[model samples]
Target: MISMIMVLNQKGDIMISRQYRDDVGRAAADSFRLQVVAAKETGTEAPVKRIENCSFLYTRHLNMYFVALTRSNVNPALVFEYLFQLIRILKAYLGEDFDENAMRNNMTLIYELMDETMDFGYPQNCAVDVLRLYINLGNVRPQDEPEPSQLTSQITGAIDWRREGIRHKKNEVYIDVLESVNLLLSSNGNVLRNEVTGQVQMNTKLTGMPECKFGLNDKLVIDKEKEDRKPGVEIDDCTFHRCVRLGKFDADRTITFIPPDGEFELMRYRVTDNINLPFRIIPAVQEEQGMTKVSINLKVIANFSDQLYATHVVLKVPVPKNTAKAKIKHSFGRAKYEPEQQAIVWRVKRFAGKAECHINAEVDLMPTVRPKPWSRPPINVEFQVPMFTASGVHVRFLRVYDKSGYHTNRWVRYITKAGNYQIRI
Candidate 1:
């Protein structure tokens, strides 16, 4: 339930504004521009500011502020999620051109999309794939624009994500299980907080409406089947797309639903327990002789499979703001001084697992008139491990049933990526 939606540029100029209810006025737009943008207040400090009995909840995008106004005390999460979904859909349509210029060029299509997505301040069938079915942008209305009733019927249908009479030449499905592990490390090499956030993305190229059932290594399913309950990670919490049937999942812990045609995020989950950390970073910084010069010793060791290698490994180690120059030495990587960021940047093209690399840097600080104490920042590490998952999450099975019963093949992939993986220096 949103009453009004407004898009403003970085300069607080309204690019677009739409009012769904009479209670929300045009003046609410100026109030938001004045209170949030002009005041330079972040959403963290004041996410929801009420004026004239209307609440304006806003979030900043790349070069715009997406402001949502609601008269009733509706769910804030619902509003924010819808706003994000709106952006994703636009980006899907515009691709790399999803910016201010793109918006200006496609204003007509944008308004049409806004009308299709929201009605009476409630979201309808706004899934990008589903929307692209009828809202043809190419002037050739995708076979003469099926009548309004036909489109509306499909929109209100149970399987709105999939259009009827859909068929693909190949009968195959590919599922990608990708996880990003985030960690906040304390000084002296201690793990302060760590978690794994994962997503299951599916690309289905099949014929007919295939009723699919997905399985995970959940405790309830394992206990009911009396199967081999292997030692794996537990999914703490999960959220699924609308295509996923919530009733069936709630009843049997089974993911039973009709997936969308193209690539769509099926489910997202978080794992906190039993996270296998793949890297260990040790950093030591101390005064070599005086405050002007400091010596730093850093070591990065990969703890995963010895046969595998991490790609695009980057380490950003911070130094004092008055860093004049940095003498860098490394074992298996290239290290350089980044004066703009006041940090020592290191890079390794390929880091073999079960291997270790080291970096040593002597940073000379410029003589500052006022020598203040330095507050060191963490050393952030970034890498991608293919065919690996830090959470140990595996797909148990994917069973598909269709009226056609055409044979099908399934493919699965696993990847682990860095999500704010840092070590306090």
Candidate 2:
């Protein structure tokens, strides 16, 4: 019984060895056949001659046999050795300029071979280390009559590539390996790692510009001569005159204005004296119906010496008399009023020692008279005039008025004045 068992075991071993030899022979034959076909398609007679050479055939068959062994179903230890040998073969091929399309096709074969043995699980560290070795070998530049000994020495001194040990798992690992191999083949040398390092450094440097802030107290001063170019007020080119300071007040501050056409210039100043307090004066931007609206914000500080009193804001606008008419609209909370003119008058209800107030004034334009003769009529141009006095002092409503006057009643005619003048008091 013992003799029979020994004979069976020996027969089994021999059968396995024969199968392994057959697999290697088949792989080498298939690879050589493909190479011959490719050579014929490209009309390359040299490839056929080289394959026929004794030394070339021997090396080719040995490399293909190793590649076959690496993909075999048994002996994982031998598989690792064969994989390393295959790496060396790839390094040699990649060192020379090979057809990019052909290399891509061959890589698919290699992928399949590697996948088949994945169940046995490759040594994670060995795979990375071997890949690193291949990367170093592929980076060597070819010289006239390149020496294999010199190239091998250079690769040996290079850092171990496998130190990272397939850091990424599953699909990522496969993808990275494929990319590394493609890069090596494409460059005819290893330049991908260096290029990637440079890109990362550049990206880091670009992400460092400082953030900007438009602070509340920051003022933008406009140089009238440099900024304005139009005949009338240039709204778009206007700059912020003063940054609103929280505590102190900016009294008697002036802002220079330039007309759009550059034909006229005006200087505007804010004044808060014993009779008035610091307030914001906003200019009208648009006209609706027959009125133009202007917004105003008035604030009286606690330490301000002036007693809270009535406030007045002035504005100037050119209106074509034949085409446009002007009216004033003012609102204080829910209370609203519209008068026929350009100035707004604010009356304080109670002397609240110190208080803040906001008022909106709108100026609208309308045609003073219709085009038909029957519809035409005389129109009154009224301007708003504001007056303020001490509490005990009795002041008449008409104590102060605009130099342009209260109202101008003019008859509509074809030769009527072409423009209306608005003045804020």
Candidate 3:
């Protein structure tokens, strides 16, 4: 439970403060500025800080800080989640660039929104859509206002995300499975770290309160089936949208939810086991002639099917800081020495699958007084491939049910990209 909410500027001065409960005094707000924000400036990751009987949970957006003070032992996740929700709600009402100036102008409306979202010390309806129905910056017409009974139902309803009577002529559901592969490779061709983070994004245009049941080729379900006992993609951890019935999913490995209108992320998952690496980078760096010159060779091989190709592949190969010039050559991409970055920037517009590309560079070092050894930085890579999943995860089925029993169209697309991918030279 939140006792007080405070919005502070970059200098830790209070901009907008609201007190929900009298348990925590106004001095608690000062504690956050002194202890939390001050410590944060000195490279401290204090998202939650306890001071004098009050606990402060805060998040920073631009130059403002949203903080919550609580006296009781509250769920930290819920507090942080509510803080994020408050930020989104304010952005929805105020424009995206809502800064100190905007906050000053709409102080009254912001306070009203704070009162509506949190009652006493508990979080209530924080749906932006529902709040916009009654609360408005401009004058709301009598005809535009919803009935009292309808408004009450909406605020107290189980479906907090969606409104009633949504229609579509051609019902369609678009699912996009996007996975980002992060890899850290050692100099001796060893994968130090390999991880794939993925998300299921859905764009729903179906009418009525349609229930969606999504299925993935998960190892848990495969083991439960007990047929063939073949292994599936192992998900380390996953989080679903609030609309999903978590209790049902816990009982059975079945994902079921009543999706909101338009586009929303259905779920996010992380995978570490058996990651299908798309690219294999082999690097050889040699210091020639007593560190006066350096020779670098790199081989990039694609490991996917030959049918699909990757686009906009960029590889940053680090060079010495005090380098005179670089003579670089590549087979499949354009390579140029970037002085500011101190690296060879290579760009390949189209990289065919099951293909190999090579790069050779001879770097001449500039004579320096101290002659300090160069610290070789890791090579960073970035690319995107359509119709591919680095985690080898596939959607088995997507079942939708509604009272109208209308026919719906569904489309599924897959994309794999590089994220934090690096190779030590």
TM-score of model number 3: 0.89
1 or 3, greater by lDDT: 3
- Sort every candidate by lDDT, greatest first: 3, 1, 2
TM-score of 1: 0.91
Question: Model 1 segments beyond 4 Å from truth?
Answer: 40-45, 144-150, 223-226, 367-370
The true-versus-predicted C-alpha distance at residue 116 of model 1, in Å, is 2.4
Q: Candidate 2: worst 10 consecutive residues by lDDT?
A: 173-182
TM-score of 2: 0.16
111-145: candidate 3 lDDT, tens digit per residue: 99999999998988787767887788877555546
Best-to-worst ranking by TM-score: 1, 3, 2
Find the 10 residues in a row with the least total lDDT in model 3: 37-46
- In model 3, pairs of residues that clash are none
Per-residue lDDT of candidate 1, residues 59-158 (tens digit): 8768788889999989999888888888888888877447787777878888888888899899775788778877656677666345778678778887
lDDT of each: 0.85, 0.25, 0.89
Better of 2 and 3 by lDDT: 3
Residue-by-residue lDDT tens digits, candidate 2, 251-298: 222321111110111111111112111222223233333433222332
Write down the TM-score of every candidate. 0.91, 0.16, 0.89
